[model samples]
Target chain A: DVKVTQSSRYLVKRTGEKVFLECVQDMDHENMFWYRQDPGLGLRLIYFSYDVKMKEKGDIPEGYSVSREKKERFSLILESASTNQTSMYLCASTSGPAEKPQHFGDGTRLSIL
Target chain B: AQTVTQSQPEMSVQEAETVTLSCTYDTSESNYYLFWYKQPPSRQMILVIRQEAYKQQNATENRFSVNFQKAAKSFSLKISDSQLGDTAMYFCAFEGGGSNYKLTFGKGTLLTVNP
Candidate 1:
């Protein structure tokens, strides 16, 4: 089975602080994604990396950035955490295409105070 | 751009009963894929089923079956003999087949199964 692991299951940060969310996949998938899920809105993509050092902005990419320095690790960076940034963060990896099902890590529930 | 819609925001069913979740999408492309993903309380996303636009027959896995209408762009999931473990948030997603592997997901339906 494919395993996608996130660095933290839950996190607490103060406003104006920087935060990092890490994710690693054992399957060496070529595509990795970061999304923030909110209550009325579905999973909106924040950023995605197709290959090492390759990144693309998704529908909602503001105040957030991503890093893919290695094949197995993808990191989401919050430039300046705010109360509004508190939400569940999900990381997913896919071997090739979106047609193939993505394996998601247990999400990180972030709280910014 | 493609959009997925789940008309029902919440649903409930008694254990051992049957329930259906509706999903519809709008896409200009003819070739794409649809999927039903379940996220339980554990917050882990699990793929329940998938359907290709070219195939007419619905996809089924154990107790989960999908009613795929390509022309209507409607793909609904029917869960038979629902169990307590079946309670979760179900999301309907669409993937335009090609180099772009981005998935467009619905707002999701929160389903409850009472014993």
Candidate 2:
């Protein structure tokens, strides 16, 4: 089985603070993704990296950025956390083609007060 | 751009009964893929089933199956002999052939299995 691990499951941050969310996958998948899961809106992609040091913006990438220093690790950075940024964050990794279902980590439920 | 729609916000089924979750999508692309993902409370999300646009036969996994209507752009999941463990938020997703890496997901349907 594939294991995708997120650094934190439950996180609390204050407004205007900078936040970092870490994700590491054991399977060494080539593709890694960061998504924001919210009520009614579902999961919207924040950023995705096809390979190490290569990143592409997804549908919702406004206040977020990503870094992939290693193939197994992907990080999501919130430049300035706000109350509206409070939501569940999901990390997924996939190998080869898009037809293959992505392996997801246990999500991080972030709360910005 | 592709869009997935799960009209039912919430649904319930009795144990050992059958239930269906409706999913509709809109896309101009001829070739694509559809997926159903399950997210259980406090657990990792997993893929429930998948269907390719070209395949005529519905995809089935154990007691879970999909009803795929290509013309109508409909894909519905049917769970036979449902179990309580099936309770979760079911999300219908679409992956276009041109952009296989990205997926468009629906709002999700919350299904509860009762004893």
Candidate 3:
């Protein structure tokens, strides 16, 4: 079984503060993704990393950045957290094959005050 | 650009009953894949079933199955003998063939199963 672990299951941050969400996968998958889930909006991609030091913007990338210094870890950075940024964040990883299904972490419920 | 649509926002079914969740997608690519993901209140997304465009046979996993129509670009999920554990938000997703592995997901359908 593949295991994807998120560093925090829940987080609280104040407005204009910097926030970091960390994710690690034991499967050594080549692809890692960050997504935010909001009510009625479902899950929207924030950023994705295909390999170490390689990142790509997804549908909604504003105010967010990603780091992939190693193959097993991917981090999502919120430049300046706001109340609107409060939502559930998910991290997923999958093997190189496009047909493979992604394995997701438990997700971090972020709250910005 | 590829987009997935789940017209039904919420659905309910009694235990031991069957329920179907509809999903439709628009894509120009002929080779692609479709998926049904289940996210319970636990907030963990789990893959329920998958269908490949090239395959005519519908994909099934236990009590869950998909009705895939290639020409219509329709893929619906059917859950039989639904249980309380089956209650969750179901998302329809699409993945294009070749290099791009990113999945485009629908807004999702919240399914509730009553005992």
Question: How do the residues B7-83 of candidate 2 rate in per-residue lDDT, one tens digit apiece?
Answer: 99999999999999999999999988999999998668899999999999999999999999999999999999999
- State the fraction of real interface contacts model 1 keeps: 0.67
State the lDDT of candidate 3 residue by residue for B5-70, as single tens digits: 999999999999999999999999999989999999888999999888999999999999999999
| Model 1 C-alpha lDDT per residue in residues A38-72, reported as the tens digit of each score | 99798999999999999999988998999999999
Candidate 1 has a DockQ of 0.76
Against the true structure, candidate 1 has what lDDT? 0.94
Task: List where candidate 2 sits over 4 angstroms from the true fold.
Answer: none
TM-score of the second chain in candidate 2:
0.97
Candidate 1 structure quality by residue, lDDT tens digits, B25-58:
9998988889999999989999999998888899
Off by over 4 Å in 1: none
Each model's Cα RMSD = 1.0, 0.9, 0.9
Report, to 2 decimal places, the DockQ of model 3. Answer: 0.77
How accurate locally is residue A50 in candidate 2, as Cα lDDT from 0 to 100? 87
TM-score, per-candidate, Cα-based: 0.98, 0.98, 0.98
RMSD of 3: 0.9
The CAPRI category of model 1 is medium
TM-score of chain A of each: 0.97, 0.97, 0.97
